[model samples]
Each structure stands twice: as C-alpha cells, then as structure tokens.
Target chain A: MTAVPNGHDGLITARGLYLSFGAIPALVDVDIDLWPGEVLAVVGESGSGKTTLLNVLSGRVAPDAGAVLYTDPEGEQHDVHTMPAPALRTLHRSDWGFVHQDPKQNLRMNVSAGGNVGERLMARGARHYGTIRAEAIDWLTQVEIDADRVDDLPRTFSGGMLQRLQIARTLVTHPRLVFMDEPTGGLDVSVQARLLDLIRTLVARLGIAAVLVTHDIAVARLLAHRIAVMQRGRVVETGLTDQVLDDPQHAYTQLLVSSVLQV
Target chain B: MIRTEGLAKTFTLHLRGGMQLPVFSGIDLTVHSGECVVLSGPSGAGKSTLMRSLYGNYRAGAGHIWIRHHGGMVDIAASEPRIVLAVRRETLVYVSQFLRVVPRVSTLDIVADEPITRGIAPDEARDMAGSLLLRLNIPRRMHGIPPATFSGGEQQRVNVARGFIAAHPILLLDEPTASLDAENRSVVVGMIQEAKARGTAVVAICHDADVRAAIADRLYPLSPAREAA
Candidate 1:
C-alpha cells in the first residue's frame, strides 16, 4: 500500500474492493497488486474473507464496489467486472488458472487424466488429438505423475495424485496467472510436503504468477514472494513474505504468525 | 561497501496491544571493502537483528542502509521489496545462525544454487560447492541429503559453505561459527580471512572471542538501546 514497486503496473490489480453476502461483509476495502511471475499469498484465519477476496479477484464473484483491472499481454488493461462475460471466459480459459482447494471441484472425475489435460488445449483451439495427447502426457510428467497413468480415471488416483492431476490440467494451458486456493490443503503432512515441493518447482520453472490463499503461514512462507495479512475482510499488513513473517508489523498479522509456533 | 545512518529497529507488538520494543536506534556504522567488522555485544543487544536488517529481511523503522550494489548506492530502507531482493541476490549474502532448509533439496544443490542463479554453469557451480563442502569437512555422502537431517553443527557447516561459495561482494554472518567444533571454527575463520582478502566487505556477529580476535579488523560495539534511548 505504501510503495508501488517502481510503478510498472501489475498483471492484475484489485483496488478498494468491498463485497457483502447479504448482511455479512465478505470483503472490505481490500487492495492488491500482483506482478508478473510473482507469487502473492493471502493468509488469515477462517472467515477472514480470503476465499471471497480470491473469488472477486478472479472475476468469479462480483464485488459490490471497487475495480479489478487486468493487463493483457498486448498491454491493454481490461476492467475485469466491466468486461463482457465471453471475453472474461476467454481470459479464464487462456491467461488465467483457478486451482480449487478440492481437486474434485476443478477436475471431472469421469474423464481420464490425459483427457482432462488435453481438454484445455482443445478448448484453446488445438484440433489435433495427437499433439494434444502429447502435450497432455508432457504435462503429467511435469507434475511428477507417470505418463503411463495418463489413461487412468481420476477416481483411481489418490488424493495427492488427484491434486497433482488437477495441477497438470491447469498448467497444461500455461496460464500466466494462477489462482490457487489452498493447493496443498486437505492432504496428509507428507503428501502436502511433496505437493508443495512440486508446486514450488513448477511455479519457479514456468515463472507463473500466483495469488495463493491459505490459512497455513508455512505455505505462504514456502511459496509466496509477498504476503497480505487479512482479518475481518481487511488487509492489516502487506509486505515481503520474509519481512512480514519474521517481523510482523500489524496486530492481526502478529497474532496470525505467532499462532504457528516452531515445533 | 556497506554504510548505515541512524539505522534503527523497533518492534510494536500488536498482539500485546501495541507495546513498542526498541531494539536499537540512532546508530551509524560503516565497513569498507576488504574489512571485517565484528559486532561485539551481549545477548539481546540486537546483533542478529542488525544482520537481518542488513540482509533486508526486516524493514527498518528509520534510517538509511546505503549499500554498494551493482556499482551504485541503493538505500534498502527506501527501496521496494523487488529492489531489495535484487540487491540481496546480486550484491549481499548472509549466513545466519540456522540453515532454513528447503524440503528435499540436496545439500550440494543448496550451496550450488547461489552461483547457479548468479549465472555460473551448473556443473562448475556444483563442483565448486562440492569442493567447499569438502573443505568445510562435510562428508561426501552428506552432499546428496538435505540439511534437515543434519545435526546443528553439520547444518551450520553447510550454511558456512553456502555463504562462502558465491563470493558475493558483501557478506553478513550472524554467529557463523556458533555450533562448530574448534577445528571447524578455525576452518571458518580461515575462510572469512580468504573472503576479506578478495576485497569483500564482511560484517559479522561472533560471540566466540577467539574467532573474533582472529578475524576482526575492527570491533564495533553496540551498546544496549535501552541505555541510549
């Protein structure tokens, strides 16, 4: 909020956002700027409006007030809420990825893993099934899933493998910006560690910008370049991940960080 | 190569209802190239905090940290996170009291990662990393394992190896030899001397008096801020 980081506009910027679910405020005066290839984590306790903020930023949920501006590759900025539905859908299909906390929400369990991955490329206008299949296999490998498992149905995969398949399906499109809502959540600790490592490597290797929402401070510390601490639908503090985590400046941030003690 | 003016850090513990803990303030410090300045102070005198501030891990509440980065002076306090990270990668390097291990990253790759990111070839970087680890007495078998499984002394040695391998222009070491045996401590002392011989600006906080005596060109004593404030 204080420094604009040399004034190069972010790939996505949401300013002064306010949203309400009838009587309850879900988001209140939240502002965020995510630069290209930078991972920004939104961290707070449950009911901190983190998921609501992500939905609004990704154009899934419309905010009652404020603007979400997205700069396309051509340097043209699109007002996300004002954009036509079809155009925003195209953006979601091409330049943006949304990885849900539950892989089941993102993946079609009936589709084979390979079919799931290739479908995105097909949606992007790839007509040749062979090429799409090759790229799908390649992505499965990238996400550390075996290529031989390509034809297996999602129902056959373990929870961690399903998440990995979902990640492969999302990343097969090479979306420049990813919206990850607890990509490592809901798994055992060991599985979570592996998935986190995979996400870190993939995000770094591709230089994919991400806006990750997690209640886990350790996840933020592991994956984020910047951290925005939220409480009661408001950003209490925002800064470099190491700075905020190690030397928290806000009361809510301090509490959020101090809650996770070193084992 | 490193200069600070009125450098101060105060923590306002928000959970404690905004209780301000002044670590230090009103300080001026400087270290020229090829010099090793040891921060001599008792515990709780903000020695490690100063090291973290220099590395841009903590946002200083007041003052300027003018660092010679990429042949230009940049004040890290005023700079944004992007600029601060750039300064850290290209110019500044730090070895803290503990190794913050990334899960499953091999110890060799951990040390080699610094040079590899800074444009060295991976093969050459790993070779250099291997040699440094060997010199620091890390066994050959330990290189393939992550530092998470390493003992305190072993991990500290890996940290020492990593800090020296890149040969960055500015080095900040916080208790670099804290948990090591006398032999490894002396080995680290020798490495610090070698780093300084190459015109690197080193600022360290070493409580070991013998190690301090061997490497310190000047002792910059930090008085308790509680006394000064």
Candidate 2:
C-alpha cells in the first residue's frame, strides 16, 4: 500500500493494479507511474511481469482489480478500465506507438516500405495520395531508408531494415507515449548496437515518454532514464537509471545488477 | 515531449517559379519532460519553422518530428490532420507570438474556454483563468473586455495565460516574452519553471538572451541547412 510514490507528475498512473491468468497472479497490487518524456525501463528475468505491466499500461490487457489513470495531452485524467471503446481505440491510434520484439509481427510484409509508413497516415484519415506519398518518403528517410526503395516490399528487406521500417510506421503519427518490448532482442550484437543507437536517438529527439520492457540490463542501462526492477510480479526497486544500476538498495536489485556485471 | 531526427524544412517560392529555398535540414533535437529547450540561431534560419513542425503547423521536407501525444509517439510530419488536431488539443500546447481570439469574446471567456473544453466545470475554469490573468497582472476591470483593444504585451499575457492553463505534456512557445516588460518577463520565466517542474516538456524560441539563458536546459541552434556539415 505504501509502495507507490506520492506527488509525482505521472503521465500514466496505476494504483493497486491486480491481474491474474486463471488462479495464478500476473500482477499483484502493482503501482507505478509512467512519467512524461522519461524512459522508465521495466527490467527483470522472464516471467517477472515486465511485459505484463507493459501490456496493462498500454490498455492491451485488462486487470481484474485496481485502476489505471492516464493523463491525456490536455491534462485530463481518465480511468483506463472504464474508458469508452472508441476513446480507447483513438488513444491507441493517436497517442501511443508500440514497437514489438518482432518486426514481422508489426509490419505488413507484403506492403511496400512506403506503404507501411503511409498506412498509418491513412488510418489517421489522410486521403490525398500525393501528400501521403510525400510523407512516406519523408518518414522513410527519417528512419534511414533510401527513398528509391519506397515501392519495395518489406519482405525483401533485411532484419535490421525491417525493424527500422517498423519504427517509422509506428512513430509517424507522433504518439504521446511509446511501448517497446525487447526491441533489440534478436538482432546481432552489432545490429543491436546500431538499432539501439537509432532508438535512443529517436526517443531523445521526440521526447516521447517510454515504457521499455527488457530482460537485458545492458539495454536498460543504455537507454533508460529510470529503472523499475520487477521480481515475482512486483516492483522490488525503482529509481534513477544510474542510481539503481550502481548502488542498488533492495536485495533483489543487487542480485540483478551483480548478475549483469558477472556476464 | 518532442523528438526529432534529421528533421528538415524548406520553402518553395511558387511566386519565384518554385525556387526551392532551404531553411534548415539535418536537424536533430529532443526536449524532455520537466526540461525547457530554447531554439536559437539567426532570424530566417527556420527556428520557428522547427517549432511549427513540432506543432504540425508546417510539413517537414525530410526527417521525423515525433511528439508524445495521447499515448503514442506520433510523427507530426506525416500524421493525418485529425491525429495532429487531437494531439494539439490534448498533448501539444502551443503559444504563438500573438493572440488569436474569436470576435467579441471577452478576455476572460477566451482564456476560460480552454479548460472548459477539457471538461473542467465552467465556474472552476473561470476561476483558474482569473487567477492566471491576475498572476500575469491583467487588470481586473479589463477581464470582461475583449483582448482586441489591449496592448501587445497585454494580449500576449492573455495568450500565455490560456496556454499555461492546460498544463499539457508538451508546450511550444514562440517568442513568449517578446512584448513583455522585465517584470512581466520574470513572471513568465517563473511560470515556465513551474511548468517544467510539473513534468511539462517545453520547446520555445526567444530572442532575448537573458530570458533564454534563464529558462533553457539546453540551446538548440537551428543553423541554415546550406551550412550542414
């Protein structure tokens, strides 16, 4: 009950959030806040509810009890549990972007590179063909894609390029928050470095508040402004990125940090 | 909050038979929550254009202008107008150099309307607007008067008051203190600091060196695109 911080400028606040998969609990009285313009990394071993917290915060999964309050850009707080379906849909479409672990799962591989980016614009109601095409070119270039490959299908692209395109597609609308789950999980080390650099650059440049879920503490150390260390479906420690990584307070946190060091 | 990557903007002079004029390009910057970023550079270098692009007022020639609005990182350069409008309404709050008000609306009403639209009670909204106006030192007598007859500084104060009332996640200010006197400018600086402490991300343009130095966490110089290194 006393775990959640008080007087925080939370962009998204969860209070007593509880969820379960059948009889087994997924989240137990969890409380956290997604602050504005700061990357709050949820790091833990697998099955620690890092991804589950992400899903709950993003409104992709419903909790059995407790409430999640989301502050819209206009500063009005809405209860996520009872928010209207259309409003929730609009929130998903306009205010949030998700970068999944696999690019193929997020990208329309049969579509051309430009089409993947432009499709988001169309979803937002862009009708003029020329404007959409121009924006697609602009976004493609932003994500480091050559404009000449605008018409090339994503299926033809390499793994890293596909991830970049997926980022372009998700970010083109300038959503208020971004949810990323293991964005660089499967890439080669070199590719992961490059992609992580790009993601770091994009996240910083957009000032987009992010809730990044990762098991890799290195990734968390590299990009997160703050860290929320999860264990047994509960947050065992949370603090500024460097502080939590360097001088961990909780027993679980020290173990987690030391484990990363050992490797 | 706002982020950019290799963001570029240019103007096509159709009157000059489509003579392409490069304003600035290859720009990359980020303004974080509770942080104030001041856009600087010489005039005509597209400092305001960059701010405008973040607000979705101008289309970018190249690169991405990502804004966190509603719940997502939206690319303002490419998102549809409806999506941009939604972001503008809720997430990105912009204060232009001048005030634009509906005809015949009282200054109080104009300022009060923002919070009201955001679902605050009408009376409560008016009270908030009144206090903000008073903080900016607007005369109580003129609260009912239209801002059309106010001086440049007075109008600007009203505009600022209206913008600050929302406490939106991202704030874009264009020459916020251009018309204010020293005292009023100091008040504005304080207001900006308060906004930042509340976790509002701010990107603003200011010609005044003192004001820029006081509020800026960092300076983003928008040099001309032709000089790209």
Candidate 3:
C-alpha cells in the first residue's frame, strides 16, 4: 500500500480493495490515490491484478472488501463501491472516461469514426448533428487522425489509427479522469511510440488525470508521472517514475527494472 | 509468391444526381514467400481494395493475379468463384482490424471453427483451439464464454487464434493491432513473428510506421498514380 500524497486534490482513492473470482483472488488489500493532472501507470505481469484494480476504480467490478473513493468535479467524494447502479452510470457517463485494451470494444465498430466520437456527445444529450460532427472532428484532429476518415467505419482504419480514433472518442466527452488499460498494447513498435507520444501530449493539454494500466515498463516510463508496480493483487511499489525505475527499493521493482534491456 | 499484373477494381457510387465515382483502377504489385510486405497509404487509396482482390473478395475489372502455391500456379483473377472460395478458406487467412465475432458463439467454438470447418475432427479442433488460446494467454475459464462478453483485447486475441488455427501459409492482416494497449500490441507482434517463423507469407495493410517497422520486411506505398502503374 502506498500513502496518498499531500497538496494535490485527490481525484480517485482506493483503500483496502479486494476482489476475487470463484476461488482465485484477483486483487487484495490494494490502496491507490490519483491526483488531478497526474498520470499514474499501473504495471504488472499477466494476471497480476492490474485490470482488476482498474475495473474496481471504474465501477465495472465491485470489490469484495474496502472502498473506491472518487471525487467528482463538484468536489464531492463518493464511495464508488456503494453507489447505486443508476448513479454509477451517471457518474461514468459524465465524469469518467475509460479506454479498454482493445479499441474496438470501446468503439462502436459498425459506425463511422465520427459517429463513434459523436456517440459520446449524444449520450450526454447533444442532439444537433452538425455540432456533434464538428466537435468529433476537432477531437479526431487533436488525436492526429485524419478528419476525412470521419465517415469511414473503424473497420477501414489501420490498427494504430483505430487506437487514435478510440482516444478521440473517449476524450470528446471531456471527462475529468480517463482510465486507460494497456492503451498501446498491440501496436507495432513504431506505432506504439507515436501513440504513446500522442497520449502524453493530450493528457497534458487537456489537464486530465489518467490511470494507465500496462505490463510494459517502457510504456509507463514514457507516459506516466508516477508508477505503481503490482504483483498478485498487491501494490509492491509506488513512487515517481524516475525514482521507482532508476532506484527501485522493492525487490520486485528491482527485478522488474532489471528485466528491461537498457539500450 | 503472388504477383498481380494490371489488376484493377472499380465501383460506381450513385450520388444524389446519379453521377458515378471510380473507387480504384489499374493496381499492380507482387508479394513473395518468406517476406512480410506492408501496403501503406492514406484513406481511399485502395489498399484494402487491392488486398481484397488477391483473395477474390472483389472481381478484378482488368488484368490477373498469379499465385504460386505448392501444387501449381493458379490465376487468382481467373479462378472459379468456388475455387477462389476454397483457396481462401484453406490456404489464405485474413484477420481484419475490426473483429467480426459471430453472434451467439462461444470463444472456444469460434476458434475451433477454423479447423472444424476445414474438416478436422471436432475433438481434435477443440484440442488445437485450446492450445492456441493458452499460447495467446486467454484464460481457460474464458474458453466457454461468449465472445461478445469478453473484453476487446480478449476478442482480438480470440480472432487471431482462430485465424492462425488453420496454419494457412499466406496470412493477410488488415491493421490487426489498432487500438490495443502496449502489452496487447507486443502480443500481436509476437504472434506475427511466430506466424512468419511458421513460413506464413504475411501481407499486412498498415499506416502506422511503427507497426510496419515492427513486422514488415518490405513496404509498398499505395498512391493513386502508383496504383495505376
């Protein structure tokens, strides 16, 4: 467990979180704090409970123990664990944006790229077509995808481009906190570099806090301000990206850093 | 090796005034075995159209495509529709970027269908599918779950697993890794490397330089004028 840092407003807090499926524990005794305008990378190997922690924070999976505390833009702290379904849905729609490991799951694959972005605005009741399209195009441009592909189905775009479109769709809603799970996992190495660069730029420009869950240390190093290393549902280490990566105190952190082939 | 000579595809789009638009015309290219070739271009550059022609998804308006398989050289352009279908089903596999998971199908069944459809025993197909799922890191519990219920990355992995099950020698991927996180991307790249190592001739359509740089051994840029050539 890592203590919450001071001064910055805490946007999301998880204390003593525990989750299990059947006889297997996915996460246990996990505590994390996300501050405004900070990008926190959650790193772990496969089945290391990184995705479970993300699901708990985003209200997709209920924790068997403890609480997920989230502060809305209005400065009200709500226990995500206990929120009513409808209230949680509302909070998800208005305040939180989630990007899945696969862009297609987050995006409506049948619709055009613009429609995917516009769907978010429409969900919040922006019905005027032209206004929605304009806003969608603006977001697409921001994400570095061509605005011309707005009418093309996501099926037509390349893998890296589709990821950019997904980013555009999520950010179009202007959510305060974005949760990205392995945002660049399946791209080619060069595309991965470019997409990571785009995410770094957009997170800073939008001033949106993000919790990035990934298994790649290099990805965390590129995009995250703070890094939390997890193993078997426990937060093994958490600190500034440089401190944790360069001078890892925990043995697990040291092992993780050591595994990377330093160029 | 696969070679296209003056292959062309065109579609007439009916506008409000009933005018026509030509989508693509006169494309020529060649792909050799033991090589990974990437087709790159902006939107509407006919990259997908050209790739589709190789598999006979669309009839070529002119010229021909010759594919040298183990048995003999076949004119893909002039092959019978049924023959083309059989060829695509048995020898060529295409993994589109946007996953097309059939409705009401379990993940295991979806993957196993590749082998079963091609005449493998159901039991053997199931065993093979299980092995692939394991290699792809999809949990055993998820094997029986409907693909619709799985997350995006999970579905994509299932899709890849299915595509590779047949051990098709020529695999066509249309932006397979788009929108995936770094871990998933690495997994997909690794899968491609494995496929290549298995002697699959991979033709991938991608715009992301990183993706091409990661997997492509050769690159072909598709421009309107170059497509005419």
Candidate 4:
C-alpha cells in the first residue's frame, strides 16, 4: 500500500464545467476540486448529471465550456480539455483509474480474471506473463477475491465477486486517482458491506484520491469525506458527509436524506 | 405459482479427451405467487443456471418443474419446446444482469417489442414502455436513442423496463440492480415490490444483502456442494 503523500493539496480543479447531450444540457457551470488522499462523493438522483460530471473528469467526454486543470505526479499542471493525445494517454495510464457501475461492461467477460488485472500493465508495455500473473494474483488477494479463481473467466463470477475483480483490475496499476460509479449498487447487504470495507481500507492504505458517484446516501456517508449533492444538472449542496447527509439544506438533499429507509 | 420436484441439471463437458464435468444435480425449489424469493451463493454456485432452468433456458437432464399458471398446472419437463416458448413469450420474463439490447434497436422499441410480439397493440405497447421509463426516472427524450451508446446504468434501466413492460406474471431477474446506484436501486426495488403485490411470482438471483433484505420474502442459499454434484 502506498502512503498518502504529505501536504498533497489539490490534484484536480474543474472550473465552469458544462456538458450537453446534443441540445439537452446535462451539466451547467459545475466546479469541483479534489485533493490527494481524500474521497469525494458525488450524490444525486437519477438523471441529475452526476455521471456526466464524471465523464468529463475522466476524459471520456469533453466539456463544452470551462477547463479541467489536472496536476500530474511530477507537479505539472495540464489543461485536461486541451491536452495533447499522447500526454492525455500518459496521464490516463499513470495517474487515473475508472470503475463503472456495471463490472461486466468495464471488464472483458471472455478473459480470465488475471488477464483483466494485467491489462493495464500490458498496456504500459509489460510483456512477461509470469510477472504480470504474479502481480495479478497479489492484487486479487489484496481485493479479497480468492486467488484460486484467477484463471476463471469473469462470466462465471457473481455480481459482488465481479465488482471486486473490477476494482482489483483498475487499482493494480496503482493510479494516483480512482473514480468509481456506484461501486456497490446492486450488491446484497453483506456483499455491499464487505466491498465498502475493502474500498475504505485500500484507499486509506494507498492514499489515493477518489471521486465516487453514488445514489445511496449511506454509501456516501460511509466512504466519503466530503459530499457534493447535485440535482437537475447543478450542485445544490457541498459539505462534509455527515453534515450534508444529516442536515441537508436544499429541499432535494433533505428529501434524499429523509427518503432513506433504515433496514 | 411454481414447484420443482428434485429438479436437476447436469452439463456434460467434453474435454480434450472427451471427459465429462458435472455442473449441478438434485436441486429442489419453489416460488409462490405474491412472494419474492432471493437465491444467493458464492460465484459459480449455479444460481444463474437454476434461474435459467426455471424458465427453461437450459433443458434439465432430470427431474420435473411444474408451473401453475392461470390456465393450468403444466409439467415443464414434459412439455413441447414450442409450448414452453409460447409460455415464456407470454407469461415469463427474464432479466439478465448484462443488458442484451439488439443492435440498432431504439430504447422505446426495445421495451415495446415483447408486448408487440405477443400481440399487444403497437400504440398500447409504446404507451406501456413510455410509462415504465417515466416511472423509472429515465428522461423522456432518451426513448428514441439507440441503447448502444447509453451509459451502463442507463442501459440497465432500459433493459429492466423492457423486461417488465408486459407485466408478465413470472419474472426472473439476475442481479437486476447490479448496474444501479443507491437511488435507482430503491426505485427498481419498489417496482419489483409492486410487481409482487400485483401477484407476479418473482425469483431474483442477487448478491446484494440490502436488496435481498428489502424485497425478498424468502431466501435460498445455493451451496457449492450442490453445484459441484
């Protein structure tokens, strides 16, 4: 596990971010700042532009306005929107990991678990399968997935197991920042609890900053340090998780907090 | 209502030397109307296989499945393939964890296809699809877009909408909320609960404890010993 860097300040800063799907504006003038070694939960109802914001941040979708300024490990700041292709690729390879809501969509269903974890390493030019397999096994163990299943294809894994595999695959490369969209969304309560525990431990041990997009307030309360509440394509509230969740100021936030069914 | 008598499925795996591998055997389960049952187990415990077998996705090697429908109780094992197909098309709905939208199909059309195929009027089917999307909080404009480009969560919602568009009495869901966030999970769960209240016999294979606790009236744990035969 990598140590959280001391005095690691803002790593990513987005100002006046705007995104649209054709003519329908998904996000409008959103601003966010993420520091190293902290978890920031982006919470919102469905169709609230929470995912659009993540897409812009991850470089999968470009913003229509404003700038996404990211600071690399070497302390160089680059405008993410206008960065050169090679530089962007390097940033993606060395600095960022993304976990989508559906593990099957993010994972290569036809390949072995080890192959998925080793893909990032292979992309960065690691050729020896022996070394890659070793690393993959280590990562699988780290994520609490059974190492014996390393040779099994993802199609055979259960939903919770698949999510864990996806996490191991993304984090094996040791990226500085990770973005997870609904990491524990559909998991059984036991599985959700286990996955959340694993994520909390891994993030703390590695000191990797993360942006987690979730609709579950409990998840945000458990894993996030700071929470940003979004609604109708805008940030309605932003504060510490406990404060935002327990004492939400906006009507939407209040409704979300109140709507949570205690099980 | 549905009942299984020592229901068993075993796949004969032909290895390089033609050796066979037994997948599962001698499984018994039942699902009653107005009830939601969750089947959970470790990965590769044959949860999906069992769910698929209920809808006849996999032909059982042995045992019998008796489905009690409005028409009558029919032995699924002894029924003709065409009869099973007709029953599945009209009365049973299966939602796989991964969205399986056909290429070039619009979201609206995907949801409306099953009902239309089953002879529901096109306009009524479209209305049903639209209402389902609205209930699930999917934006109205997205109805016309092809599901191919939608995000993972969005596509899953479309898939769920399509699966239940006809309000089939028997619904099988394999991790229906696997791609949903917390809010959407609740919405989908509520929808499922509504279906159960409407007397739909639902068997959901899930790994989420929260979902199971929220919706399942009964639970079954698939054992590895049972899966390995």
| Candidate with the greatest lDDT versus the true structure | 1
Q: On residues A1-263, what C-alpha lDDT tens digit does candidate 3 reach at each position?
A: 35643323588887888888889989888888887877899998899999989988898988999888888777788888788889998877878899887998888889999999999899999999999999999998988888888899999899999999988988888888999999989898878867886787678667788999999988888777778899888898876664467546566776677788844
Output the lDDT of residue B3, model 2: 82
Candidate with best DockQ: 1
The TM-score measured for candidate 4 stands at 0.52
Model 2 deviation from native, Cα RMSD in Å: 21.3
Ranking by TM-score: 1, 2, 3, 4
Better of 1 and 3 by DockQ: 1
lDDT of 2 by residue, B1-229 (tens): 6889998876654444546678887888988889999988998878887887777666677899988876778998776443565687799888999776544568998898878767788899999999999999998999999898999999999999999998898999999999999999999999999999999998999999999998999988776667323
TM-score-superior candidate, 1 or 3: 1
Candidate 2's docking class is incorrect
What tens digits encode model 2's per-residue C-alpha lDDT throughout A1-263? 13345333578888888888887788987888777777889998999898999988888899888888888877888887799988988888788889999999889988899999999989899999999999999988988899999999998898888999999999999887999999989888767866776787678678798999999888887788778888888887776665567546567776787776542
Interface RMSD of each: 1.3, 25.5, 27.4, 26.4
CA shift at A143, candidate 2, in angstroms?
Answer: 1.5
Q: What is the C-alpha lDDT profile of model 4 across A26-75, one tens digit per residue?
A: 88878888887778999999999998899898777898897877888777
Q: What is the DockQ of candidate 3?
A: 0.01
How far does residue A88 in candidate 3 sit from its true spot (Å)? 1.3
lDDT of 1 by residue, B116-197 (tens): 7677888999999999999999989999998998899999999999889878899999999999999999999999999899
Ranking by lDDT: 1, 2, 4, 3
In the range B84-136, model 4's lDDT, one tens digit per residue, is: 65577677888987665334557887788777767688899999999998888
